[model samples]
Target: MDHYSFDQLPHAVSELHQKLDSIQDLLLESRQPVPQTIELMTISQAAEFLNLSVQTLYGKVCHREIPVSKKGKRLYFYKSELEEWIKSGKKKTMSELREQLPSLVVGRKGRRH
Candidate 1:
């Protein structure tokens, strides 16, 4: 280890203090609670959240086309699951498909040349 001269002690202390402050900020940030909360909604609320009419939502539920939970006679929807359901219906663009083609070709075996 290098020895610090007397005049350098204050500068070294200030540098150490700044490092400690940065570490403390990181520690405090990691200790904070996550903000994800499970939100359950009724059929009507789910319809409004998805911007669909109640009748359309019912049709989707009857056809088992959307994520849902049935408890007794009432139906429930989780906002997170609904969000995922919407994402699952997304269509890939041509550029996305092209980007994936190389990986797709690499995974295949026994190709005829």
Candidate 2:
């Protein structure tokens, strides 16, 4: 077999090293940890989390009807606040509604015959 020249060997080794380094960089990038910082929820995600339809969420945002923060074009919500607001708006039972309605409704005595 013909022997390879030393000059060619160094070039070949350097190319191999470069290829290995590129592969290592790619692997390192792949292994990098995803950031744990709160990922701003997309409008869809927010709606799903709130159990509301997209249109409702959009309406609230447009009217400034909901508490939110904006950064550039993105809207962010505090999850805790959203959860608290939902909890506070929990629907009253039928009995609870009945109890509340009597005070607002005029009795027969108060109504004009």
Residue 102 of model 2 has an lDDT of: 75
Best by TM-score: 1
- Which digits, one per residue and each the tens of the lDDT, describe model 2 over residues 11-112? 888988999999999999999998766546777788889898989998999997776788899878877667777788789999999998877685655878
Candidate 1 local lDDT, 1-113, one digit each (tens): 76899999999999989999999999999999999889999999999999999999999999999999999999999999999999999999999999999989887855766
Question: Which regions of candidate 1 deviate over 4 angstroms?
Answer: 1-27, 30-35, 104-113
**Once model 2 is optimally superposed onto the true structure by TM-score, how far is the C-alpha of residue 67 displaced, in angstroms?**
1.8
Give the TM-score of each candidate. 0.68, 0.42
In model 2, the clashing pairs are: none
Of the candidates shown, which would achieve the greatest lDDT relative to the real structure? Answer: 1
Error at 84, model 1, angstroms: 0.2
